[model samples]
Target: MSSNAEIKISGFPEDDGYWFVKWIDEFRLPHLTTSSASVKVVLQKLGSVDFHNLNNLGSTDIRSILGQRKKDADVIIEIRCPVVMPGTLPLVFIGAIYQRGVYVGRLPTRRRTIALADGGQEGFELSLSQQITPPPGWPEGAPYSLLNRFEYSVIPNIMRSSRCLMINRGEDTFIIPRMTIFKTFYAPHTELAKAFCGGPWNDRLDEVICLDDFESGLKTQKITHPEQWNIILQVRVPDVFAPLLACFTLMSSQDRALL
Candidate 1:
């Protein structure tokens, strides 16, 4: 078996202000990590956003940010500055995501709730109430296979400047700690005890970058390089939200010239 399960994601130009995201996963291999047998999923072509247009339009038009719209695209990411202070003119940035013809959620500097685009508030609560199964085809008897899907909820910390986002399953909860060293901001590994060994703190995942060029606005690759756009995810985990987290990270990275 291969050492990693790779997923390819591509999209429009980063200079256009919006990205058209799509991902493909065959689940052909299993990546053995400290916590579980995970897969490496890479999200490439995280297109850039032109802040120039936002000034002219007076509002961030996400749908036209890519210049041309692909109605079938999986997800769309848009960056906007909703608030500004005397010295912090346009410093605060928020990312808005749209998928399946509806608004998915917003990623802000402070903690906030995420509502599914298609599902209303009731559907959002329902997903958290039940235990979600992982994608099929893992060795059925392994202990890690029993890991439940986590529902990420943002809890506001009234006393602190930034709120806390919690990932919970059953009675266990893991708080997503923030790291500013990446310049892009990233959430270090907190899946299990073993995952803490080599992460952003130790510089294992910080240096990684996407190397492939996106002249075509979209393309697919069979292999992934550590220097290029790639992601490592726990096997059979919540596949839907992984990319969302990745995009949120990229929105702050120096690679996109943001925050």
Candidate 2:
């Protein structure tokens, strides 16, 4: 992706937290491209208190393989704060935003050994820093160095009980909040497919953007109601943090079905 590449991801929600995630080429000209693949994954949850391994609800055959998971694996995204889905335990499947194996951001992990090797314990942490090397195919002049310095965290809306990602760069932090409009706008009904991007509260509602019924042309609307209305999840963040934002958004898209 070019440094100036505008990243706009808009998708229909399968239900509450699960989204029929799709990568849009541009917000103005929202459309899916051949290079882009449809990813169907559930954004598990970031329980109000702790972290868990963000799990994939269905098949693990995620379409886009940025790189191999074996020795040939180019990127390994480790969920610094390991959390697992309710049922799956011990053996955790923590992977998100991987497109054909490319978008995998290596999570910090300890070097394991066949035999017991006593050493510093790998604390549960996901730090975006110099430790994260750029994937092999990254553009030469892109912000490869700056990418490492980015510290990502989840900003929880305790009152609303929803959570969004906050990627910090010095004093500046970009927020990626997913709003499930189906519940907020049409609480009693569940037939509308909507994707809204806005502030954390009602007073800040003026700061909204969207890829839903209100958007122009409505050319990009693919996943319709009955079939996909309930599962729509809209992840809107600044263009600069799109790549990293995808990592977490795909993991935990919304705090709750409503917020």
Candidate 3:
């Protein structure tokens, strides 16, 4: 992969997190940016998670790779704080946003940031900013559509292994992840899809911006840890994210069946 292809990550802009969370009309839409069968929607949770190995931890394979664990491959997330879904983590790189092209979610890190070595002890960490929930109606204070439903969790300590961020949460051998979410207004047409882009919470300004035209926040994750915290980012197409999403179809049953 070229330097540019290596995906650039960015944090919420100091000026206004909206820039980091809202939708961008100018960015190029993905060439194949529709929810297709072979697609996957990449989302975030917190800390670093590996996609290829999950069996070690016994976590099930998340159909919605955007927020859950994967089968066979183990995922580990280390952090200082909780992983607030649909708030801290915004609409990142939407693979379905482009048709064969790619949307880049970048993190223009601060100077003097040291890189973590593979399987290194010191993992990654970032601050968990705000947790804004809009009152009843969405932005413009309109009624909320109920076509597509959404829900997410707060991940206390999710990780692959060895590499992780942490906090002394007592002797709770297993860390519980907290989840929150917003279901989309599902209509086959993109016009209906627009409503799902985002809305305001508690009557606050609908300042959350989507990363791209076709991109929207189905869920968000803001994580904190000693050395590193923040959602583990996944870049994928929406269709591919459906199973993980559990909106259209709940994966718990599927997972039980698998087990």
Find the candidate with the highest TM-score and give its number.
Answer: 1
lDDT of 1 by residue, 1-259 (tens): 1111221112212242232222111112222333222211112222334332333432224333322324524444332211111111111112433222122333222344544343321221121122344445745663221122121111111112222234454454433322112112332222221222233423332323232456865422223455443344345223443563455333445534422
- Compared with the true structure, all predictions reach lDDT values of 0.28, 0.25, 0.25
TM-score of each: 0.20, 0.17, 0.17
Better of 1 and 3 by TM-score: 1
lDDT per residue, candidate 3, 8-36, as tens digits? 23322222111111111121122245422
The segments of candidate 3 whose C-alpha lies over 4 angstroms from its true place after superposition are: 1-5, 11-171, 179-197, 200-238, 244-246, 249-259
- lDDT-based ranking: 1, 2, 3
lDDT (10s digit) by residue, model 2, range 1-259: 2221122223212222321112111111121442211222232222211112333322232322211234434443321122111111111122323222222222222343322123422122232222233457877766542122122211111112332333444454333332221223321111111112121333332222232553444421224355422112333323443332233233245533222
**Candidate 1 deviation (Cα RMSD):** 21.5
**In model 3, how large is the Cα lDDT of residue 221?**
32
